[model samples]
Target: MSKTIFFVIAICWNISLIQAQFGFEFSDSIPVEIGNDQLKFPWSGGINHAQFSTIDYDFDGLNDLFIFDRSGNQIMLFKTIEENGDYTYKYIHNAASLFPEDLRYRVQLIDYNGDDKVDLFTYGIGGIKVYKNTGNLIDGLQWEVVKEVLKSEMPNGSFSNLFVSSVDIPALYDVDGDGDLDILTFNIGGQRIEYHKNTSVENYASTDSLIFKLENECWGKFIESDVSNSIDLNSNFGPCANNGLNIPEVTPRHSGSTVLAINLNNDNYLDLILGDVSHRNITALFNDTLHANPNAVMDSLDINFPSNTTPVDIPIFPANFYLDVNHDSIKDLIVTTNASGSSENKESVWYYKNNGTNEVPNFVFSEKGFLQNQMIENGKGALPVLVDLNNDGLKDLLIGTYFQYLDPADKISKIQCYLNTGTSSEPKFKFITDDWLSLSNSGYALRMHPTFGDLNNNAKQEMILGRADGLLSLYKKTGPGIQDYSLEEITLKDYMGEVIDVGQYASPQLFDITNNGRLDLVIGKKTAGLVYYENIGTKNQYSFKWVTDDLGAIDMGNIYQTDNYSTPHFVRHEDSLHLFVGNQIGNIHYFSNLDQDIIDDNPFVAASKNFANINTGGFSSPFVSQLTDDGRYHLFVGTDLGGLWAFVADKDSEPALKLTKQDTAEKQILVFPNPSKNGIINIKTPALKKLQLKVLNSLGQVIITKELNQPLNKIDLSTYRNGVYTLLFISDSGDFTSKKVIIK
Candidate 1:
C-alpha cells in the first residue's frame, strides 16, 4: 500500500491494519525533517526553561500547548495543529501576570467546564489564573481573572500572606461531582492546596469557587478525584495540621518535592505517596478504609535520602518518582538525586516498597554508575522507567544519566538498564547492560529518549531509543533474562539532512506508523522533528519512513498509549514535531489513532544568546513523564528552560497554545571577525533597530548594527565585550525574534 493510504488506514482503523499482517514487509525510506512554524522568544540573560504543559483545550481532537516562562511568572499558550504540522503560538497569556515576578513552575490546562474548550489553571505569583476558552482566538483568547485564593487582603493596601505560596503542581478532576471540572493546585509553601471548582451554571465557562482547601500538611492524590461534599480523602492523607505542616528551625525552602496518590497496594481506591523535600521522610497513605468516610489511618515511611547521618545517605532531591518498580501488586517509588559523597556532581537511584512499618516504607538502594566499571566521576540527568527488559514477567528499571560536563575526566552520557530478579525476599537489582543507547550504533552520533514496547510482535517487548547523532537503536530480547539481548542500530542518515537533536529531550515511542504488519518506531528528532521507521520482522530489520504532513516544532517527549486490543489506537501527544522548536516546549506529545496524519507544521524558534556558543551537549533532553493523567493515560514533558508539559490520549486532540504577535522585526543584522574576538558592532538598517544586545550582562546594549541600506553587511567590533550575546534584533518585524552572536 502507498504511504499516504497506509497512514489514512492506520488512523481510521488504527492499529488493526498494522497488526493484521504479521510478517508484512516494512518500508525502506525514512522521511524526516524539522518542525513547522517555530517562534523563538527573546531574553536578555540566561533562561532555564523546563517542560511545557499540554492539554486538548478546545476538545477539537487536538491537544493545545501551554508553556511556563522561565522565571515562572507567565504561561505562553499555543494552538496545536495535528494535520499538516501547524504549531503556531497564537497567544501568550501570563497566568501570573498580576503577581510578582516569581517563577511559577507547575501549571495545568484542562476543560473544567466540559464545554469543549480547556481552561487554564496554574500556580502563578501567589495565586492562580483561570483563562477561559472563549471558543474564539480572534480577539486573542480572553482570560477571566481567577482570584488568588492563597492571598488574603490586609487592613492596609498590602496583602497578608496566609500560606507560603509556591506552585507544587496542578491536576484536574471532577472533584465536586457537579459534573463540572475542578482544579487541584498543590502549594509547596505550607503543604496546602486550594481545590477551586468551577461553580458556573453554564458548562461553557465558570468562575472558580474555592471548594476544598485541604491544608496544614503537604499531602495529595497523584490523580485528581471527584469526591464531592466531604474531606474523607484528606482525613486519611497521613497527617494534617489544623494550621499547616510548618516546621520550626529550617528556613522556609521550596524543596522540589512531590505528592501523588495511586493504587499502590492494588486497592481500587487511590493511595497517597508524599515526598518530604525538606526532611528525609516519604509517607504513604494506604487506602485500607473502604468506608465512604474512610477512617483509614495515614502511615509514614522514610525513603532515606543519601546523607552522612544515616546508614544510607538520604536522597538529596527526592525526584524521579515512578509507579510499580517491582511489578508486584504493590506500587513502588524511584528517587533520583545527587550522589552521597559529591553534591555538585553525582547521581543515584533509590527504590521503595508500598507497604512497610511507620518508620520504614520499604526502601532499597541501587548505585548507578558507568556499566563499563569506571569509577563514577559524576552523572546528572536522572530518569528511571520500569519495564520487562529481559522479557521476564517481573519489571526492571532503565536509567539515563545526565553528563554534567565535568572536566576532561568526565565520560559521555551513559544509558543503562537493570534486570529485576523479581526476588522480593532480598530483591536484587543487578546492572544488566549498558551502551551509548542514544548514540547511533552505525558509528554516527545520535541521542534518543529510551522507551519500551513490542516492536517486533514477538510477544516480548523491545527497547526503542533515538540518538542525537541521528540514529534509532532497536534492542531485541534474545532470551528470558536481562543479559540476553541483541542490538540493531538503525542509522537514520538518509532521513535527517542535518545532525540535529533527535530524541534530544523526547523519549522514543513505539507504534505502527505504517500500516504494515508489525509495530514501527516513531521519534521526534532534533533537525527533523517527527519521523517513522517500519519494522521488518522477517529480516529483523527496520526501514525508515516519514509520517506524512508531520513537520512540527522541536520535538521533546513523545509517548504512545493503547486501549483497543484488536484495533489499537495511537495518539501523538506533544508540542509541534517539526519546524523550529519554540522557547516554550511541551512536556510530551500525545497522539491518538485519529491523529496519525495530523502533523505540527510551523514550530516556533527564538534565538537566544543563552543557547549561543554554549555546549548544550547533555543539557538538552526533554523532561519526560511516565505517569497517567486523570486515569486516562497520559505522558508529560518538562523543558530544560521552559516548564512542564503533558499529553493525554483519547478522542480529544492534543492541547495547543495560542500566542499573538507581541512584536516582530528584522533588519540588516551583522557581526564581523568571522567567529570574532574582542567585540562586534551590529549595524542594521531602519534606524539601528530600537533594541539592546548585551554580552550576558546589562552593561552593554546594541552598540552598532551594520545595515547601511544593504541587506548583507558586516558587524566589526575590535574592542568590546568577549562573551556570548543572544543578539536581540528588533525592527518592523516582531520584536521577539532572537539570534545568537559571540565575541572572542
Candidate 2:
C-alpha cells in the first residue's frame, strides 16, 4: 500500500512495455544557451524579420549559421566551435552591413553564377547589394560587392519606384536554362519584379564587370511597337516599363512580399510563387515555356505569359516555404499567421496536402490534422521550420515566437515542436503539449526564419534561432525522437508524505461533499466501499485526515458484491445524502443517509434500496446531476461499451427499462485467447448469477450454447476453422453482453 513501493515496482515493470506510438515530446530543459552575454551585444529590439542561411563558409564540411541582424544592421555568424567534448557557438564576425539606419534588409546566400562558392545577396531601401565570396577569413568569410543597383535599370530611368519601394526577398534560379543563376526581386512600390539576367556566363572566377540588364516586358503590359527585330532599351524605362513581372492589382501586395521560384508542376521549369505578410491567400504563376521566346525582342519576351490567365490561389497566404515534408517527392506548402486575426483565426501553422500531378498539382486541406493554435501563441512574425528533430525519418515542425520587450504582460516566450506522425505519403502530426522548451528572458521577440544543421557533424541537427535582442541560441537535439514518459506507482506512505491516512482506495473523487466551502476527497475501494477525507490543510498546502466516523467504509456487498465499485458520487436531497452505487453489471443501486450519521454497524440495513436499472451493458461509472433546469435528478451512466446513458430518476422507485436486442449486442463482452492457437478460448462476464452464452459462426447458425455458472468460462474451439465468430452472454436478469472473436 506504500506509494513509493508501488511506484518503484510499476517503473520496473513498464521498462519493457512498448508505448502507444502517438504524440510528440521535447526537452524539459534547455541543453544549450547562447545569449547576449556571448554575443557581446546589448539586447536591442531582438532580430525582427530575420532571415537565415546555412553554409560551410570555412570549408569545414560542417554547416555554420548566418543571420541578418536587423537591429544592429549587420550580418552575424555563429561559427561552430568544438572543445574537449562540447560543441559551442563562437561569435565569429558581423560579416557585412546594410545602410545602418535601414533595418529592412533581407539576406540570402546562393551560388549565383554556379561557381560552387556561395555568394551573399542583401536587399533593402538602398537597393540590391551582391557580395561575392572571396574565400574564408580567419575571423569570418570575406565578401566583396560585385553588383550594386541604386536606381531602376529601365530606359531613361523613368520611374523612381524601383529605388524607393521596398524590395521583396529575391528568388535566385536559372530562369532560361542558362548555367548562371538569375535574380528575381519583387518591388512593393513598383508593383513589379525585376529579373536580372546574369550576362557573364563562361568566366567563373572574376565578377568585377558582371553585366545584369533588365529584361524589358518580362512581367509588364506588352508594347508591340517596341519589338523591332532585337529588343531596344530606348523606350523601355517609362512608368511600369521594366520587363519585370507585374503584380495584379487584385492580388494584395504589401512591404512583406516574398517571392520563391520552384518547379511547382514538375515541369522541369521554375515557376514563380508570391506571398505577402498581410494577404489572405498565396498566388502561383505556373511556368509555361511554350509562350516564352528568349530570342524575341524585349517587349516580346514570353516570361510574362501564364498557362492560366489568373494565378493559382493557395489557402495559406503567408507561406514560408514549399518543402517535401512527407518525403513524397512532391512539395508541400507551410504557412503561419499572427494574432491580429479573430480568435478562430489566431496565429498558427498550417500545411496543405499535395495531391500529385507535377504540372499544376492540387492541394487538399485537412480538418482535424492541423496543430491547434494554442500550442504556440500568436506567431505574428515567426516562421515555422520543417526538420527531422528526432531523426525519426519523419519531419517535425518548430515554431518560435515572443512578445515585445518590456511588455507589461509577463507572457513566456518559447519554441514549440509538433512531431509528424504520418509518412511521406500521408502525414499525421500532433503538438507536444507538456514538454515545451521555454526561452524565458532569451529575448522579447524572435526572427521569422530559423536555420537547422548538424553544426558539429554529429549526425544530429542543431537549431539556431535569432532573437530580437540581437542574440541567437543553438538548440541541439539532445535525445532521440521525443521524450518517453510513463506513469509509475509509489508507496502509499511516500505519496502521502505528512498527510494522515484515509483508507485503501482504487478511484478517487474530489469535491465539497459536505458543503463546507472547502473541497473534500472521496474514494471507492473494492472491499472498503466508500471513505471520505476532510480538508484540514491551508491555502498553500493540502493535508487530509480520515473521517473515521460519519461515512467510514459503507459496505456495498448487499446490493452488489463489493468487487469492482466505481468512484462514488454524492448528491444531497432534502438534507439527506443520496449515495448512488454503480457496479460492473450496469445497475445503479441507491442508498440514502436519512439521519446524516451512521447509527448502526450496518448502514445498508435501513438505507440500501434499488434505484434505477438504466442497463447500459456493463457500467464503468455513474453520476447524478440535474441536466435540465427543472429540479429533477438524472442518473448518467458510463458503459464499458464506450457510451453514456442518461435516465430520469427523480422518484425513489426503479425506472422502467427496455433495451433492443441490437443495443445489447453492441456492448463489449470480454473474450481472450481470441486467435486460439491452443484451440481454447475464455469468455468473462461481470454477472454473478447463471448466464447463457451462445457462439455463432459467420452464417446465422448457432455453433454452441452453454450455461456459464462462474464469471470465467472456457470453451474449446480446436475443431473450428480459422475465421471470425460472435459471442453472446445472456444473464438470468435478461441483460446481455456481446463480443466478436477470431480463431486462427
Candidate 3:
C-alpha cells in the first residue's frame, strides 16, 4: 500500500481500538435522579424570560434565590425555608420603591458594608441605589434604601455627561486587597472605567462613604499600581504616567458601552476588555502583572482586532461566549452572527480556534469539519463540548441551543449532537437528528447547558444537562455501534427522596473532589449558590447515590454576586484538589483542598479552603487544563465580553521531575534559569561535542533538535510557545540526560 493509504488504514485501526476500549453500554429506563427538591424550583412567569440570581442573603447555610420578573417589573426573593427542601418566594415590596418601575436596572445583593447581611445594590438611571438589609422581618427581609453613594462621591460624579445615563456595568470587588469591596464601574458617557475606593472606617455605616481624589487620578493609574509595570496608553505622548514605560496605547472609540475586567495573561491582575461597537470589534488589554510585584501598575498588550482575517473577522457583537472548542486545551472564541438572508449557506457559528500560547492567544477561525447548514438561528448560546459521543475515538461536537425571544411553550429548542465521521487530523461531522440521539423533544422545555464527563467511569462520556427549570438530567450512550444510540434521563434526589431543584442556569460539574476514585458532583445555581453532591455509588453497577447531607451545600459566599450565571472548574495542584468557580461578575474564587477524607459527610467543609479571588469580569465559564507541555495546568477563563483570560497555577512554576545526582554529575550539563521569560537559555556542558540536544513539549513531542558543536551553546526559544518543555542531551557514550524548562 502507498504511504497515504497505509496512514488511512492505521488511523482506522486506531479508531477501532479506541472505540472498543472506551465504548459504554447505556442502561435501560430513564436515569435515576440522584438528589432531592433542594434543586427544583416552580416555574414562575414564563420560564423563557426569567432572570435568576443565586446568593445566601441571610447567611442561613441554605442558598436563597432572586428571580427578576421583567414583564411584571418586579423582583421576587425566594428564601431557602428548608435546608434541602422548598423555597418560599416573596415579592420584595420595598424593592419596587427603591428600584425604577422599568426593568432596565441591574440588582446585586452583596455585603458591601461588612455587616454579614447581604445588602442590595441597584444600578439605574440616576446612580447606584444601596439598600441596607436591616434584618429578617416577619414577612421577609427588610431592606432600607440609603443615599446614592456612587453618584455623589465617586470620581465620575464630576463628569456632567454621565448624570443622565447610568453606569453600564458595575462590579464590587476588593481590587486593592484592603479587605473592603471597592466599586468598579464603566460609565455610560466614556470609555474609562471609574474605581471608587472603600475608605469606610466603620462597618455598616452609611456615613462611611467613598471619596474620589487626584491621589488615584485615573483608573489606569490604579491598574498600574496593581500590576507589575506602568501601562503606556499613549506611548507616543511623551512620558504618560508612572515613569515612561513604553507600552501599547488603547484608544477607546465607543463611549457609553461595555468594559469587562479579567486577568487575560494569567498574571493574577485584572485586565480590561472594551467593546468597540462602532468598529464591530473588541479590544483586549492584556494585564502584564509580574509575579514579583503584587500591587504594581499592569503594563498592557492590545489585541485590538481579531487577526484581521477569516474566522476572527466575523462581526462579533458585545454578547459572545467561549469554550475550548477544539480541545487543544486552549479556550477558543465562539461567535454567532444573525442568519443570512441569501440562499447560499453562510457560516453563522464561527469557531475562532486559539493558535497562540496560553498567555498570548491568537484565535484562528476554523474553515472545515463543521457544517454551515446545521447552524441554528439566533442561538442563545453554544457550548463546544469535545467528547467521543459516538464511541468513535474522535471528539464530536455537541451544540446546545436556547432560541432567543422564543416562547418555551413553542417547544423548538434542542441539543444538537454531531458525530465525528472523519479522522483526528481533519475532523468531519454529520449532524445527528435521529430519534434516538436528537434531544429536540425534551430539549424544548430543557433549555440546557450540557456538560460531558464519565460519571460512571465506564470510559464512555455521559451528558449532564443543566435545565432552565432548575433540574439536572443525564444522558448516556446505550450501545457500542455507531448506529446504536439511546438517551436516558438520570434523576437526582436526596436521602429524603425529595427532588433537588438545582436553580436556573444550572452548571453541573463532575469531578473526583475527594480523590475517592468516584466522581463527585458540584452543581452551580444562578439563584441558589452551589450544591455539592458526593458520589457514593458503586462501580459494579451503573446506579449512583450522591450524598449531600454531610457537607450540606457549602456556600462560596455569593461569588456570582448579582449574576446568576457561573461555572466551576477543578484542578489538582500537588496532592490537593483546587476548585476555581467563575461568576458573571468576572471574578474567580480559588478553593484549595485542606482535607482528603471522603468518608466524612462534611469533609469538604473542613477540607476546602478559599484562597484567592481573581477578577475576570463576566465570564461564561472557567477552564482548567494543561495548556503547555510543562506538566503544570493553566486556568483559561472564557468571558462574555469577547476575550479569553489565562492564569497559571502557583504550583505549576516548579519542575515536574527532580534531577538525579548521578545523571547530573556524569553529564555535568547546566541549563541556566529553569523558568525563563525571555525565551532564551544557555546550556553549558563539559565537552559538549558529539552530543545531540532535543527539546520536547509536555506530550513528549519533540519540537527542536540540534547537534552540539561547542562546550557552551545558546538555545533561543523565541519561536516556541509558553509552557513546560524538556531538554534532552544524548552523548556519544550512549548516555542520555534530560532537564525541564518553563517558558513564561
Candidate 4:
C-alpha cells in the first residue's frame, strides 16, 4: 500500500512546526533539532498512546521513520525520500523483520560520543535499552542486544528506576540548562507534567551513559494541584470543571494524551503543547519567558502564565504518524490506530480541518474513515461464538459486544450476527445486525458469552446465552432465517432439582460425554473449572440436571475478575476432545482430555498457552468450529475491545511453532552486565519477591550467599577471578530461579 494516503485523508492542519528548533537562550544550553529542513516532525496515532523511532538509515542525512502501526505488533519503517529539497517516504516492507515483534515502543537514534555512527535507545515499560548500529543497514540489523539500564535518582536522594511507566511517551529536551537532553512528559487524564533532568552532562562523565534526577515533578504550571480547584475559578478549564484536581473529567473535550515543548508564537522560548491523543485538539501552553533573558532555568510557573485557552482542539493525535502526505509543507493527521473516531467510523484515515486558531481550535469533524478496510469494528468486549446459524453448511458468526470506546444509545448486552458469505475453509463475514435480537454504547462494558446447542431435539440449533446476571437464556429458532430466533426465559435446575446460579459470564457448550445420543451441557463460570449439566428427559423434551460445578481441575490465574471473567469452549474431533479457554490476562490456553468421560473425573492436561500468538488483550472468549470432520477447524477469538480475530486452516497440517511457550524459565528475572567488565553485576527481578540467593564459583564452591527482599539488587563479583559462575535463587513458598553469570 502507498504510505501517502492522500485520497482518504486530505486534512490540512497548521499546528505550527515553527517550534522545529526548540532552542534555548540559556547560559549553558544545548539545542535539539526537532524537525528537519522542512520543519516536519513525523509523528501522530493510537487511542491516546503512540511511540515511534526516527533514523537516517540509508546515510541520506534526511531522517527516515519507524512508526507504531497499532493494530499489528510488527516493526513498521518508512524511509524518507528527498527530491528537489522536498521530502517523501516509501514504506519499507522488509524493514519489519529487522526489529523484534513487541508492542509499540519509542525508538530513537542517539550518538553518545562525537562519532556520527548511530546508536539506538528504546523506551519501553520493562525498562530502556541501548543498541549500537552494526553498520549493516541493508539486509539485516541483527544488532547485538546489550543490557543497559538507565539509572535514576529519586527526589529524596534514593534510587529506584526510570520506567517508561513514569512517563508514557516523554519529550526529550535540555530542560535543566545542563547542555544535555532531559525528559518532559504529560499524560492523559493525569495531573502534572514531569521534568526528568539529565545530570551526566553536569558531572562531565567519562562514560557515555546518561544518568537522570527528578528536577521538577510538575514542570508546567498548566497542570497545578489547584488549577481545577476553586482557587483557579477564572481559568478556562476551571470555569468549566470543578473536580478540584489538576485535570478535568470531561472526555475528548478536555482530555489529552501527549505533551511536547515547542515555540508556537515565533517567540524564541519553547512553549508546551498537549498533543491530541484521546481527543482531536492541540492545547497550547505558551511560555511567557523569552530565551536567555532568564537563561535555561525551566520554571513550571512560566507555562501558560497568562493562561492560554484550555484547548484549541486540533488533530495532533497521539500514536499517529505525521508526514506532509500531500507535500503541502503542513502536517496533517494520520489515523492508522483505531484510537479516535465515531462508532460509524471505519478503519480508515480520519481527519478534520482546523477552522479556528491556536486558542479555540475549531476543528471540522466532517470526515469519515479515509481508507475502506474490511474490518467490522463491533464495539468492545468481542465474545465471538461460531455456529451454522443459517444452515448453509458454512459456519456463521455470533458476537457479544460490551460497547467500549464506541458509544451507542443503549449500554445493554446484545448479540450481533455475521453471515459468512464465503466458503467454510476461508470465511468472509458480512455484519447483519447487532440486536439480531438491538443497536450500540460508545464507552460502556458488560459481560456476555454466546454458544449454540439443540435443546429439544430440534433440527435447527438454538442460542444459549450466558449473561452478566449469572443466568442462562434460551433463544429458540422460530423460522429458517438467520434472525428467526425468539427469546425464551430459562430456569436451570441442579441434579437435585434445585435452581443454581453459575456466576457471571457463563460460557455454555453442548456435547454428549457418554455418547448416549443426548446432548449434555458444559458451562464456564466466573471462577476456574467447568460446570456440567446432564440431560435426563427424552430426546423430544429437554430437562437438565446440574451434576458438577467443577468438571475438571483447571484454574485460570486471577486477572481482576471484578469485571473480566474467563470463558470456555469445547472442540471434539473423534476420540480426543480439546478444551480452549479464554482468560482475563489476554491469553488463550488449551487442554486435551485424558479420556472421553469428563464427569468421571479425568484430568485434562494443558496443551499450549502460546498457540498461534493468540492474545485477546484480556476478556477473551474463545471458539473453534470444525471445517471438516477429519480434524480441520477454524479458530475465532474475541477480545474486551469487541474485536474478532479468525485463524483458519485450509490443509490438514497446522502452522509450525504455533504451539510454543514464550515465557521460559530464563524470563523470570534479569541479570544485567553479565559478561562483567568490573565484576559489578546487577540483579533486577521484577517478577519474584523475597528471594534467597546463592552464588557458586567454578569448581562448585559456595563463594557468596545472601537474601534479597526487593526487586533491584547489586552484587560485586570483582574479587573473584573472571570465569563463569552459577547464581541460584530459592524461595520457600515460591518458584526457584537460576541464571549463569560470566565475569570476563
TM-score for all models, in order of appearance: 0.32, 0.34, 0.37, 0.60
Q: Residue 292 error for model 3, in Å? A: 60
Please write out the lDDT profile of model 1 over residues 1-744, one tens digit for every residue: 111110111111112111111111111111111122111221111122222445544345655554443232334444555445534333322223222232344445566555666566555465454455443422223344444544433223354333333424343455434565544334433333433334453433443443333322333322112221112334333233322333222233443444443444434443454443333344445654442212223333323332212223334323334333332433344443312212223333344444543233343444432110121111333334456665545455555543332233333555555455534222234454554333323343222346666644467667755554544556766777554556754533323433223434434556554445555555543333445444545324334444421332333322431110000113332422211111122112222233333333334232221221111212323222222222222222222321112222221212211111122233234444334444544444334345433332212234555323454344554543343444443333323233445454
Positional deviation of 436 in candidate 4, in angstroms? 2.8
lDDT string, candidate 4, 123-204, tens digits: 5544456665544332224343443656567666886555444224455566644456666654333455555667766687
Higher-ranked by lDDT: 1 or 2: 2
Cα error, residue 275 of model 1, in Å, equals 2.7
Report, for all candidates in order, the number of backbone clashes.
Answer: 149, 24, 45, 28
lDDT of 3 by residue, 285-325 (tens): 65445422222344555544454455233332331233344
Worst 10 residues of 1 by lDDT: 1-10
Candidate 3 segments whose C-alpha is farther than 4 A from its true place: 1-386, 392-437, 440-447, 453-458, 480-485, 493-498, 542-546, 549-564, 573-575, 597-616, 626-638, 641-744
Q: Write the per-residue lDDT of candidate 2 for residues 1-744, one digit (tens) a residue.
A: 111110111111110010100001111111111221122221111232234555565667555555553322334455666567555544442233211222344666777655666777666445666677655423234455665653344544453323323435566666656566656665444344556555556345433334555553344222212112112222343334433333233333344456677665564655655554434455555444443423222222222122233222222224344544443456555443311211112223345656765456565543211322112322222223456766667666554432222222333445555566656533334556412454444343432224354434466655544434322233556767553211121122211554223332233444555655444555554454565566566433334556642263454354544454434566665555555655544445555552344334345432222243233223235555443333444444443222223345322211211111122321334568655555588866555557798887544247889998877889986676544566666555444444556665
How many Å off is the CA of 243 in candidate 1? 11
Evaluate model 4: give its TM-score: 0.60
RMSD of each: 22.6, 28.1, 23.9, 16.4
How high is the lDDT of residue 556 in model 2?
Answer: 39
